[model samples]
Target: MQPLTKLLHFGYQQALSSLFPVIIFLTLAGTKAIQVPGLPRYDLILLVCVMAQIIMVKTGLETKDELKVITLFHIFGLVLELYKVHMGSWAYPDFAYSKIAGVPLYSGFMYASVASYMVQAWRRLDLMIVRWPHAYWTIPLGALIYINFFSHHFVYDIRWVLTGALFVIFLRTMVYFTVDHERFKMPLTLSFFLIGFFIWIAENISTLLDGYRYPNQGDTWELVHIGKISSWFLLVVVSFIIVAQLKRVKGEGFANQPVPHAKDRNM
Candidate 1:
């Protein structure tokens, strides 16, 4: 197939794959087959994920680096999610519909795929913010996003939150060292990965500790416990070392150096 056709095909597959989870949840809701906790109506998370993917596919503005960054983020997210489930940080109400391993296939796989699109949207918007740097809008926008998590329909996972926070710190350190030593300038890809890592940790931690778990319904707190938290930390440190080495090898010849008033087409 031609390159353009191939990209279109990939986009279609990604869109359908990402939307599958939302479709399943809606169908389940209609038939009353499964009822998720902390969720009153249909699966809004699934809807948001699907919508984000659709918007990106329609825009046709994605670059190879953006795709690479998003793909890696989702891969890392899935790995962390599998760990969360194994640790019993959270439990699914319906075992029958569980997809991959223990996770609903849609939730485990499709939802993650959808997250890539969401990250891309955030990147595009982030660029605009970087350009405009409006304190008035940024603070309010950040608060709005944070507040939305408290709503009844939105369940925060505590274990993920803690893990995510550590990840963000790790990424921030990576960025600071890279820029400080003139090894490599921070790019959106690196920033997004750091943001995603932190988010994943934060969301899981929030839900596991303070957020709600449903169906089996109990008032007792699960308490924060992650045997693998140290493992994740080690991984982040190792990843930073590797990325730093790679950056050094590429040196100043690497084309992604930061430029003012200019967007990185590679991204």
Candidate 2:
């Protein structure tokens, strides 16, 4: 493909992969500004999320296995939300029947959307890993990254430590993705940071729409701290490791898979 054609194809695939998240963002913006008679904003958003999931599956936009992974992300994200809210890391001050421990159920879908993007992009771009660290390295690292999210509240924050470790672990790793007939590659760690940065941008948009509030935003909305990008970066790593490792176990890792055929290429 020519340079311009390749860029267009890549952009189209990215937009397609992000369809679910775009819907969620639109729902957030819409619900915040428009209200129904009795339904809470959070409750309305939750309903839309549920309906969107069903519609995606029914329309074959998401596979059953992909939905299962996204659901796992929801559960994991909700647990993190519960703990973070209790710790005063953030607050959901809005009223809603769906609120549990001050968190609206729809919050989990934010995290699930990340997994959804990963799965969709993986399939659409035919992503593959090169020099992925062994399970022994990745599993423990993923666990520590997740644990540190909660443990940092009680102990010294070792996020920078873990961040450094991420560099060392993935230093040689590359992600190969197809843009068209040609293939392209990026440092896997760079992809992690990029995804995290974009999610941080989305987080700002979500907060601006009253999706949730940080402690600093209690009085008025301001831009989310740039430091939150580090958090999202680590979270992205954990999400990627889970999805990538599962693919490996299912015998779909890059080694066993053939280069995608032309007819099979969606981009």
Candidate 3:
């Protein structure tokens, strides 16, 4: 395949594979719209999500290790979702027997879907990193970012400071991914911004579909505020920090080998 065509194919696969959970949610919603009688919408969504995860694993779309990552995000995100719904960050905004503390059990899959995409992309794209920091630095920052998502309700929001810290730490880091025979390099920070931007777009779509509602959304649909990109960007940071560990980098490289140079794209 030509390089451009390969790039497009890579992107299509990444978007589709990573978004399996979202697809299932939207599908269950459609089923609910058609007045499926078997289960409530939220419960139906939860069931479909679980089935989707199982299917993905069985089909080898997600590996055991990747499944572990998805499980981690589900737990982490569910706890945060419970808190955010309580604090009115956003809401499930629908009736469901599966609701706990006003947040649906299905909600965490939305977050796990992000990790799903990360691990899938990592494996499919043959991803590698340049100038990655040690685990000690990233782990604590990831923890703080996750913590601030909750603590900011009472304490100060250090997200901005943490954003600066991300740049400081990953400033020199670059991610190398393959499309066809060409190897491409992107700044780690830029990749985070791009992913966050797309997630923001997904957020808007999710809200428009009534997957959830924001404060500004109600009687009519409203575009998700661009400012939410900052929030998503930080969450992306946390997600990336967690998934990057799976690569087991031995240096500024991948698979324990040194990264290739820009001019050396024959890989």
- Candidate 1 residue-wise lDDT, 1-267, digit = tens: 554664565455445433433443344445354455665322444454446545655675544444554455456555655655665655554344324555543343333443444434333232221222223543343333333323313455344444454344333231211111122234433554553465445435434432224223346645334543443343333333323333334341122323433323322
Candidate 3 minimal-lDDT segment of 10 residues? 249-258
Worst 10 contiguous positions by lDDT, candidate 1? 174-183
Q: Rank the candidates by TM-score, best first.
A: 2, 3, 1
lDDT of 2 by residue, 141-257 (tens): 999999999999899999999999989998988777888767777788999999999999999999999899999998889999999999999999999999999899886646433
Off by over 4 Å in 3: 1-3, 19-22, 249-258, 261-267
Return whichever of 1 and 2 wins on TM-score: 2
Candidate 2, residue 64: lDDT: 95
Ranked by lDDT, the better of candidates 1 and 2 is 2
Clashes of each: 28, 0, 0
Clashing pairs in 2: none
Instruction: Give lDDT for model 3.
Output: 0.81
lDDT against the true structure, per candidate, is 0.40, 0.91, 0.81
Kindly report which residue stretches of model 2 are placed more than 4 angstroms away from their true locations once superposed: 256-267
Off by over 4 Å in 1: 1-44, 60-65, 87-89, 94-98, 106-267
